[model samples]
Target chain A: MIRKSPMKQENRQTISGADFEEYFQPQNLEKALEIKAEYSDQIEVAAGTTDLLVANYEQLHQIKNWLDLDKIDELRKIEILENELHIGAMVTHLQLMKSDLIKEKLAVLAAAAEDVGSPQIRSRGTIGGNICTSSPAGDLLAPLLSYEASFKLQKAGAERIVRAEDFFTGPKRNLMEADELLTEIIIPLTENEREGAWVKVGRRKALVISTLTLSVVLEFEADKIIEAGIALGSVAPTPIRLWEVGELMLGSSLTELDYKQLGQEVKARINPIDDLRGTREYREDVAADVMVRALNEIERKRG
Target chain B: MQITFTVNGEERELEVTPYTRLLDLLREDLGLTGVKEGCGKGECGACTVIMNGELTASCLVPAPQADQAEILTVEGLGTRDDLHPIQESFVEAGAVQCGYCIPGMILAGKRLLDENPQPTEKEVRYGLSGNICRCTGYAKIIDAVMMAADKLAVEGSDSND
Candidate 1:
């Protein structure tokens, strides 16, 4: 017989179940909002429940009420409107990866999502939950911001659309209200002479937060740059579009540019911090490099 | 809460509180102990189960939220008398280590094989990436999943024949 180690046995230990209160599976956003407004902070809105369960285990107690957003039909939808693509908050990464609209219009967004986790995690985790966490290094935020996506947040009595740029306040923080649910992340559906991409350097391939990530969207008019958007993550307090870099790339001859100057402009934009993941200088330097690489790649494609 | 869902093909009702995780509901309330919880958090995939054809961490799923969904725990996949292809491959390839992560790995493999029977080695690896087995170094598990994929494919082909 194989001897099982102590840690393995402990990890395998069957947990004793507990008795708790009732849960409300709200079928619609209205019902979810009603429960949220009624319970206030006590009402936990869960789609995948990945973050919520870890938070609950630390306390090991019964939550009075839960607003199960999984039953909300509208939140699980994906649609393309008049030159716009609207993704419901409950849309999982797996769904996004499989969407032909996303594959064509928002390739960068889908690429960033492919790095989120394993397929199982993709099936369970939602795009909204990533935004709700609102970390400066939120993986999908950079690409979403690059597309200039707008977000529609809804509360019981009020609703608002905020640009993805202004949505986050700080690390793990957002402009969300107590009663509001992140209903949709809205983006343009144009596939002009424009292309975009999301790139990251993480510790490991899977299940690792990005050391730094870049999302670059490019639009051109006959080999001359018409529009450009450059967003950076994990190199600042919040994910942001490097407007100066975008401005530099907007009207330049992207065909065969050396990128030394464009690279310097990007380097001037970010203020990364030193942490266990990497050094500030390293992140900033690598971030500048990633931007340059993305720009050059897009420019080469132009050629 | 009165929760009714198809558990391992049997329609069963479970009276669970809002705070109870699905891992607990399966192990305690329903008395199906094949599901294990290594990490109460989602980081570890020890408590994985099939929820409406999707592989999800039972530790993260709330019990009441599982209502009306078709849930398949490890017990439902197969028995010792008639092992599923994935389960049989695990035994054959010596993939059973401490066996804590086995249930979740097997279920994940089942879900992946069910969806794509001819998945490549990389696909199989990524499919069961959620499940972590500290022992066995993943060689035999990968081999088992590959073997199972072939077995299932052959079986699927045979059934058609």
Candidate 2:
């Protein structure tokens, strides 16, 4: 005997049978923005869809409108304009890894991109999606924050630039409005002698979420540290720039600096929790260790 | 939603639900079983496919986003009668222990070899890092890829001559 349960039927109905209302693939950013303005709250703007499609299917099934940004050529550009590197939000990790400009100016970001999930993930994951997803452990976030990158957020007729430091609210959260789309990332290029390092520790070399990530960029003026940009990921709610550590290192010579003291300050600044990848204490411990190691890399490079 | 894409040199137009993933669309709708779904999340590269000349996890790609895109699957590589060099190398090197991860491994090797015709052993390991094979301990798989690279290089030189 065949039986039909009421609860099963209702659950299937609530899931809507995996049917979505609309799917929009706009060729240009203008049409994309128009669609965004119209269905701001209803649309799910996908950049690469690497993380989006991997997310809960129930949420995706509930989506009223799907906006695919893959067709927007304007959003996939990487250009250098007037001392700033303008990378389109849809630029994939593979593009970043293979880009000559990124390798020349932002080797740290390229290193981070190379360490991301796998070749397949790197081919599909984008910098914009990395920022928008806003995972505290995002591989690229540490490098981005270290470079003082800013995002270009666009609505239909309005656009605003938000600094990387101020963009994140918490894990998997950002300062983006429902109507706004992240269009580009602008990193101001400096002419000074700059050396940077990206050091990440994970369970395995590939296809593993990082346990901790450290990005350090040091600007040197003939041996003395003119400026230091130190950022750590997976140690805080969001990938954070160590303002105290930066303040401590400014105008101090690397040779005369107190490595042990700086390590303590780095440990003190971050607040991590026990997760599957690592324990809170382990993250706090390595947070300092990797910082010192990354600084040492910068020191070695300076020589 | 309807998406038109080229799969393995053949153009296919199909009606897929908006929530459908490219993995499902390929396997269920298109009947390409070479693509496997081990982990729906991007961690496992079992569903890896070359989409528009790039290695991408089909599981993570929404079906609607594949519109007018070019895709390549393991089935497109070679038939049973005539095996691709990579497949031949895999069989010759005894890299097919479980055989579940062979498709993704071969695709990874293909992309790697396509970009770097002559890759070092370290490079081969790095290139195939995305694929996870539970059997054979990966030594044979790496050897298979290296052997395939040599075969592909020889074939290229012969064609040129």
Candidate 3:
């Protein structure tokens, strides 16, 4: 006979089968936020439960009561506003890949979503979970940073917007308060003609954490780069915008030599640490190489 | 929590803890052992199931989250008397060796075929990337999926005729 451990018995008692009213699944966003504000410290907000479930299974997350947001219809809308694309936080990566608006306006984001996990993961993993997890190697972060996305966070009755660059403070840390729910992501759409490229170097072709990822967006004015945005991932504490590299590329027509210099500068700017996926030296070298490749691809596409 | 969901076409209501995973609920409470758990993590697709018309790793789904969801497991595909086209193809192509990963592989193939009736070899490999078949080396599994796709196409046309 198998004996149930004391810890398991205590856990079962805490979440007894007879008391099945612990899960709070609010159908509307307002109600969900109200619950969040009320039980800010005790309740965990779950979207697709892709990352949350995994963390809970690994015993990393101990929160038992969850405020499931999957039933909230308002948090799953993807709207193309007048000059920006407003994506609901609950929009899945698969949904992003399938959206025509995302494909046309935010091609780099769609590409990054396509390279996320396998089909199963993409089907359930949401942009909200990705942003809230705030992992250094989050595949969607680099592209969103490159696009200069901002988040719409809401609590019970108050709301605030935060730039994506400032949202992530460190690895697995963000600016979201305990009661604030990230309701939407707003990405500004450029009026001028522009090209974007995203490249991720992982250990395998699929379902692997990115060793180094790069996203580059360049706005052109008659063959010269008038504006540029560059974001790098997994080589820092959080996905970081390479402002220096973007500044260097501004007002200049990109050439092979310019890309080479920019790649080296990116390598010098980042402070990568040794990890299981790769050593600091490997990431430093390959981050530059991948940035150069992304620039080259953007250049080729521009031509 | 008391959750009600559709399993294989039948509605099921069960009382489960907040921490129970969909995989455990299916294998233990529902007694559907067809869904295997190779890795508790989502790294392996052995726990793959069709949830709400999308392929999902059941292990990564909390039981409460699947409250109103429609789930399809390997047992829902067909039986020994009437096998699914994919299952028949697996047998014909000798894709079943250890048989540990075949259920998830067949579900992955079903998802691929349901979306794209005729997928290329590369698409097949990409579709089944999450599932790891250490026994067949994936050559026979690919063959099985291709054969099933062909058979499904013919059946679809015949039904129209």
Candidate 4:
């Protein structure tokens, strides 16, 4: 049996099932944004209802009026535009796996989706939820960050694209306002034809929270790496894209020796804290180890 | 809250709590006890059900969330008269020991086979990992999956989808 872990709250909020009411199910993006403008503070938008349930457990009444993003047909689409892959907020992990476009365009994303909680969780969990929730150890964010991802966040009457690098402020902390909802996660569809992979280390495989995870996107010119984008999760306040390490390996032959040193250098970039998953020092060490293993596998496959 | 859904090909409408789980709705309101609640969380696949072509944990799904969705439970998958091939494989392979986890295991296995008709051993193991059996009846269960795969391939009703 899965034990219930208490969350941090000043006082628990309780809403009876009898008190439950479904308020918003906007069919289109415009209507959803209009409702967001109207029901500003009380409304909580949800796609999968996974993260919201966790947050609701923490603060009982945090979800009083639900704006069901799942019902918004426009927000539930996956489109490949001219420059980037545009995945709507309501696109479930299962849908991503079924998309041949995802497999051909972004294989690392498909691999990361495969690592999310389990088959059940994957069916409901969305990439939008993964990014908007801003969990430091979220399975999908590191990979998205590795792809130089951004989000198209829509508010009452306006929208802006925020790069993944500037997306989150801290653990469970995002710049998302009460009125703004994430419409789509945008990843530039690279025509350069590079290969990327995601690796996660958790206690167990299914329904386990990731302890340390890494995503590496490498662009190889002939036999040398022209570009490398590496991101590490569960090692910082937010999942971080390791620009320094990527710059270090920009123009080098990625051998086993180089991978070992890069792992140590990536370790130096994070400030992991002691939490329920692992101690700070343990996370730091495991972060390095997972990175090394991930880099090794990617390099070996590249060869 | 009044909720309506197609359960096991039959349309069902019921009054339930918004917090009331789909598992609870199926067992209590509808009186279909096939869907078990081992872990009242998403971790356990005991409450697994195919909701609109995707297998999901019924425990985490609120009754309101399942409104207007098409759901298939273990009871609906096979009847006493005509059992699903996966169910038949379970019976033929002697996969059921305690029978407590059979419904869930069968549901998970059915979903796996539906998605990947000819899943390898590793794929089968990963698919069934969500459903736990205390009796350690995994070997027979694996055999059942393989047997069902071969049968489905023969029948051509396989999700070749």
Best by DockQ: 3
lDDT per residue (tens digit) for residues A65-184 in model 2: 788898899998999999999999999999999999999898899999999999999999999999999999999999999899999999999999999999999999999999999999
Q: Judged by lDDT against the true structure, how good is candidate 1? A: 0.80
lDDT of 4: 0.80
Tell me the tens digit of each residue's lDDT in model 4 across B1-161. Answer: 56677888887666654455677678766767988887666776778888997778887776677878999889888789999999999999999998877888888888899889999999998888777788989999999999999998988954554
Query: Stretches of candidate 1 above 4 Å error?
Result: A1-22, A60-62, A296-303
What TM-score between 0 and 1 does chain B of candidate 4 receive? 0.93
Cα lDDT tens digits, model 1, A1-303, are: 221112123322333344333367778888777777777776677777766777678553455566778888899888988889999999998888889878888888988888876665777888998888788877889998888999999888888999999998888888888878898999986556777767888876666678998999887677677778789889899998887777766666665565776777778888889998999989878876877788767766555
Q: Give each prediction's root-mean-square deviation over alpha carbons.
A: 5.6, 5.2, 4.1, 6.1
Q: Candidate 4 falls in which docking quality class? A: acceptable
Candidate topping TM-score:
3
Q: What lDDT, from 0 to 1, does candidate 2 have?
A: 0.87
Task: Indicate the fraction of true inter-chain contacts that candidate 4 also forms.
Answer: 0.31
Candidate 3: which docking quality band? acceptable
CAPRI-style quality class for the chain A–B interface of candidate 2: acceptable
Residue pairs in clash, model 3? none
**Model-by-model DockQ, in order:** 0.28, 0.40, 0.45, 0.27
Model 3: fnat (fraction of native contacts): 0.50
- Model 4, runs deviating above 4 Å: A1-22, A54-62, A255-257, B154-161
For model 3 the local lDDT of residue B89 reads: 98
The sequence of per-residue lDDT tens digits that candidate 4 reaches over residues A1-303 is 222223113212333445455556667889888888888877877678777665564242345677777667787778888888999888988888778988778777888888888888899989899988899998888888888889898987799999988988999888888888899988887657487778888888878888888898887776577778798788899999989888898767666347778779988988889888889999888877877887778777777
